[model samples]
Target: MIQVEGLTKRYGERTAINKLTFHADKGEIVGFLGPNGAGKTTTMRILTGYMPPSEGKASVAGFDLLTQSLEVRKRVGYLPENVPLYPEMSVVQYLDFMAELRQVPNRNERVDEVMEVVHIADRAESFVSNLSKGLRQRVGLAQALLHKPEVLILDEPMEGLDPQQQIEVKRLLREVGAAQTVMLSTHILAHAQELCDRVIIINGGQIVAEDTPDRLSAQIAGGRRLQLEVDGDGDGLLAELRALPGLSSVRVVADGRFEIETAPGPDVRPLIASTVVGGGWKLLELRRERLSLEEIFIQLTREEAEAAAAAETGAPLAEGQAPGSDSAAG
Candidate 1:
């Protein structure tokens, strides 16, 4: 478990993180999302006791992050963006050394168990320099889990891997997260959508959006979209659909096909169907359109940036409202 309140960090006059607030419960996987230089790593460092926050308070696994740092450190497993490893040391030797550093009881048994858990048993004899990138990432993860810490903080766990390696790492994370608290920072929205039960989107050193994937999707919802294919009169169909009540926008794609968007909270499909059928137009297809994870992420972040800009210009804006972000439909 982790709790952070008004967590602020600064480098001289520049605030890398400003009054961030959130908490992750035990046995939950929470995704930390932001663009490059968004203070994600700074927050993680403060949480792991690697650095101190300039203001505010934090606790990890019931221990004060500042006052009880050692206890907090002992209960947290951290895998930084670049893993620290000895190139000449074999996998088993490296893990043994980490186990000793962690003061793990019965270091040998712990090393063996971590190797098995990370599926690096076969590479126990392989030197760190000899392993592939995927294997090296696995070794880094193994070291993080070597101490059996209560919480896992992984920074860009999927960054530099091929597709297959990404899948492997995702599976490993899902397995490890079953019983431990996981806080993962990533730029990939699809990864978060697939892996996290809840997501916290950060921008300009502030919390912009926080919710489940479905709920986030619903924020831009209620706009009825339809892909319609007909046997003839595509232009006429587009014009007719645009004129129909509740229909806002219409686009003709190919021969006798159109994409349509209805007004918020209105279902225009019945009108389109009845009109097409009554006018002797044969309807070949019809379906509602959906927004992708990337689209949703972009929309939310763009709004946050615009809102921050407006605040700096002395323009008053509603709290938690981002420019270009539609909070009306969903």
Candidate 2:
């Protein structure tokens, strides 16, 4: 388990993280989602005891991060964005060395156990430099688990791998996270959606959103989208649908299908169906469209950026204004 309250980090005049607050419960996988330069690495470093925060309080597994830094480090396993590895050492040898460094009991037995957990026992004798990028990543993970730490903090665990490798690593992470708490930092929205039980999105050194993927999607969607297939003149149906109250936008996907965007309100499905029937158009199919994690991520970050810009310019943001529109922040 981990807890951070008002955590702040700075590099001279620049604040890397600002008044950040969040927590991960025992055996939960929490994703730290952010774009480049969003201070994810800084936060992770502070949590792992690799660096000290300029202000605020944090605890890991009941130990205070500041006063009990050593105890905190002993319970956390960190795999940075770029894993540090020895090129000449074989996989088993490297793991053995890491186990010793961590003061793991029965170093040889621990090494074998971790190698098996990461599925690198097959390459136990291969030089780290000789292995593929994916294999090397596994080796890095093996080292992290060598001591059976209580929490795993991973930064971009799938950074340089191919699609297949990414999938493989995701599977491994799911298995490892079953019993241990995991705090993963990644810009890959899809992977975060797949792996995290809860997500904390950071932007401009601040937390913009925190919740489960489904809840976040529902919150950002605000409006509903519908796709309908009608048997009639496409242009005529498009015009009629556009005339409906609360409708925002309409697009024709093909000869018989139309995509409709609507504001959040009462059910419009009945209205849409009746309109089609009233116009003598045969309605074939109708369904609501679900927003993907990527769409939700983009919308939340854009809104936060616009709100921040508005604050800086002493302007009031208007409802329904686009993010970069002059009316929103000028």
Output the TM-score of candidate 1: 0.87
Q: Which stretches of candidate 2 lie above 4 Å from their native place?
A: 232-235, 312-330
Best by TM-score: 2
Which ten contiguous residues of candidate 2 have the minimum total lDDT?
Answer: 321-330
Show pairs that collide, candidate 2.
none
User: Model 2, 216-285: lDDT tens per residue?
Assistant: 6655554567788887655598888888998889899999798888776765777888898888888887
Go through the candidates in order and give each one's C-alpha lDDT. 0.81, 0.84
lDDT of 1 by residue, 224-252 (tens): 45677788765566667767887878888
Error of 2 at 305 (Å): 2.1
